[model samples]
Target: MSGERVAVVGVGQTEHRAVRTDVSMVGLIREAAKRALADADMTWTDIDAVVIGKAPDMFEGVVMPELFLADALGAAGKPMLRVHTAGSVGGSTAIVAAGLVQSGVHERVLTVAFEKQSESDAMWALTVPTPFQAPLVAGAGGYFAPIIRAYMQRADAPDDIGMMVAVKDRLNAIRNPYAHLKLPDIDMKTVEESPMLWEPLRYLETCPSSDGACAMVLASERVADAAAKPPAWVQGTAWRSEPTLFARRDQVNPQAGRDCAADVYQQAGITNPRADFDCAEVYVPFSWYEPMWLENLGFAEPGDGWKLTQSGATAFDGDIPWNPSGGVLSSNPIGASGMLRFAEAANQVRGAAGEHQVEGARRALGHAYGGGSQFFAMWVVGADKP
Candidate 1:
């Protein structure tokens, strides 16, 4: 919805792992940035601006991180901005970087997002103490368990639906070299036998605390036209948010997510998301979130998402593949997870995804959500310019 066309000319990510003790926070970011610049066939000096994003400061024990990271990101003399919106920061950051080019403010912008969960007690930091409210004693899993239960009841879904997702994504991770959890032997029995963490969510179904970073180089159409590699054109982008504890808030299917998806689809001329896009990379830190997001993203009717998954509609070989790169369930770097989804979608359209590539993919969708499912960011990218 803009003045100039925007395109993603390069994307890169670090090898995700539970703990990256070898690299400092700055080093983690630089590793990804360097790779992105190389993918773009450019150096740090080619960037006109820089944008970075991360989770709350308490998670890293670092405040105003952008200031300290300015030189590391090649932003010391160039315009640099930091973005934060809970887990959606990565997707939001890329949208902002694209805006700089779309609005004619910059010809090329480099955007990066990262998290080093091993360096800080993320569970403790996420357990914010609110007045008059009981403490979140069990972290993210406990907070979202009730919502998953509600969806199960509302949909009358099979008990094995979550297990199926766990198996599929883990298998997908085996194909992704950079994914953290490469559970090649993962299966339905393995997932069923795993210890339950949040009543319905088993240990095998949850995302690991990872240390990694993801970076992308966005440029104007003029620059993309001359790039060495094929560019993924940005057809549309949108973001939306609402109060976390508002009255009558539908946690199972937040209104902000629905609205945000609609806006992005409208901008991309998507009348039927399920049939329009070749694939999707959605934010699914939990296994069950895949089906939940399928409904919210307009890929399935309400209460029918689980059935779609059960029918193998979302499998890597299926018609509408989701998370061909294994997704957050396999490699979650918190703040960087969102941008990872965006980058993977871009890679799919560019025919750059090696093993998990969708055959003949021409258009794709990338999505992310945060803040108790109240904040949502989505975009559509294509091989051909819009």
Candidate 2:
């Protein structure tokens, strides 16, 4: 590998909500793309390629919708690609776009991801009948409840830890104007008292099924050098996959996630994530995964991550604050969730995150994982050019 450098010149996202019926899928994407182009001081004509990603077609009842969205996205003649990898599609899409630049294929690329769950029920979409598969799980909450309980058992993490995460992220979301679920009055007591959707998962703990889209404009080193302001240089990026439903799979702390983080850290020369990365945006649809992933992502040793969370190490004012943009816990459009994480990290570096911006965020980590803990994607972005 010649180690060609890449950087994010533009980033944009739609305000996540329960339903964005006012605009079609194409409109949602265009809105974000236009914002990104404006930020890059460019336009649709300047984009050299386009890449779109989303979760399964079942969620929107539109199989490979990107095929029909070409004209609207202004990619009629430009190179285009679509990617599907469950919930991590967004982050994975960004990685693919960055690869185009790093591989010397394209100087500019537009990557976008979206999900309009309002068109269909995600619970029903995910529970589609499969031969020999049990029909007990209703949706993601059901599928993940037992796993969360196991974490609480194995790690002996206090129940309040999950509640605290929900409250903190919800509070953080208020500052994020684009967040989907904005609980202004949320607090520890409110989270503790919220109705239980699934055992070990409360209404406050589960991610909201939202309708939104996110987009990013990536450029090569030469293109980045011409940007108006400092670009978020793509220091390192990685993606990994493992078979789902494996007998040996540890849902609580998947090795694929650990390996994925290790790869990006190694490429970026990061030996201590807790100390090196100024801030992070991790995919935590459920609050408990905050601590669980803290351990899995090498930020803390197993059985010790909860201590950090309890100590407020992951809070907004802590040593290495995480999810300063509120994260997937605050706003999740399923398909776009992962990409938003990457975009947010890029936003922090670009000094464009508005109220949720981390102070002097020089180095940041954007991370996402999905599909029964089988897929992982992460990237390290820095203010300084790579």
Candidate 3:
């Protein structure tokens, strides 16, 4: 079915860091919102609705924080919605905001996602005991280590692929001023020597707990025509979710993620994602996820995704650049992580991604996932209006 066209008119993000004590949660979100508004050349009154997202409230030790942020986000009398989809909440929130415009419910929508990990321990929060769950799993690293090992064994991948991703992404992070882990001197040797935190996963390979926010202003076709800057027109959006764990679930290359990607690509008329998209911003909190997601997203055949990484095809200057913004590994604000990926894709299509920009980029992809690889969200954006 045809829907009203939507375009991303503005994108903004906070400088991600281990702790953002200078601002309250409201202040942090407001900072990104204000920047997005400024970029859109609009005011609070111009926003018809607001949608916010983040990781679990326990991660920040706040319950229903959006209720307190309504006024700060200029949603005093307007409709405001909240989304929670684990790590994919950021991307899912943006999708909902786009739907507001696509469905003609709103002319303009403001979407924001953030996480203040300093307020609470995310590792502990995730490790909280639950009924019928194994107690042996430590943190995120421990839980995913076995999966990484399984991928390695199945694909016959070398042990150094993860380290290669770590070095490449960390080097790319140096170009992103907002990235949390800017290891300027990071190299393959450095990654190789880093202490192994969970078997196959090293300390340097894991994402950092960060406090940051991301905001975007989406507008309908009529409003987009008046945008001050080029808009990243939404070509397609799709989301999918599956039971976190089941007898037949495949965490390494989740069927839900593949379905989500296929749906979006079909809607966008993309027969070949690696050829159609100029670049991509994918959720890669763990370095190995780059290859894993490549396969799941149809960028490569099963078990062959690592070959692209090995050949540097995913580099910023490669044929199909991936994570030019350094990805979640460089800066992970939990709830905002997925939105950051979506926003970065928009920035690239708009030619606003400065140092990390893909030259002459016209189309890009944004992808995110959560909940033991069950939830998935993705979108295709382009420079021209769809």
Clashing pairs in 3: none
What is the C-alpha lDDT profile of model 2 across 145-230, one tens digit per residue?
89989999999888888888898788888899999888999988889899988988889988989999998999998999999967
* Stretch of 10 with least lDDT, candidate 1: 130-139
Task: List the global CA lDDT of all models.
Answer: 0.92, 0.88, 0.92
Query: What are the models' TM-scores?
Result: 0.98, 0.98, 0.98
Error of 3 at 166 (Å): 0.7
RMSD of candidate 1 to the truth, in angstroms, is 0.9
Q: Per-residue lDDT for 1-386 in model 3, tens only?
A: 15899999999999999999899998899989999999899999999999999999999899989999999999999999999998889999999999999898999999999999999999888889889877536767887889889999988899888888898888888889889999999888888899989989888998999999999999999999988899999999999999977899998888899999989998898999999999999999898999998899999999899999999999877898889899999999999999999999999999999899999999999999887789999999999876
lDDT: the better of candidates 1 and 2: 1
- Evaluated against the true structure, the overall lDDT of model 3 is 0.92
Candidate 1 is scored at a TM of 0.98
Supply every candidate's count of residue pairs whose N, Cα or C atoms clash at under 3 angstroms. Answer: 0, 1, 0
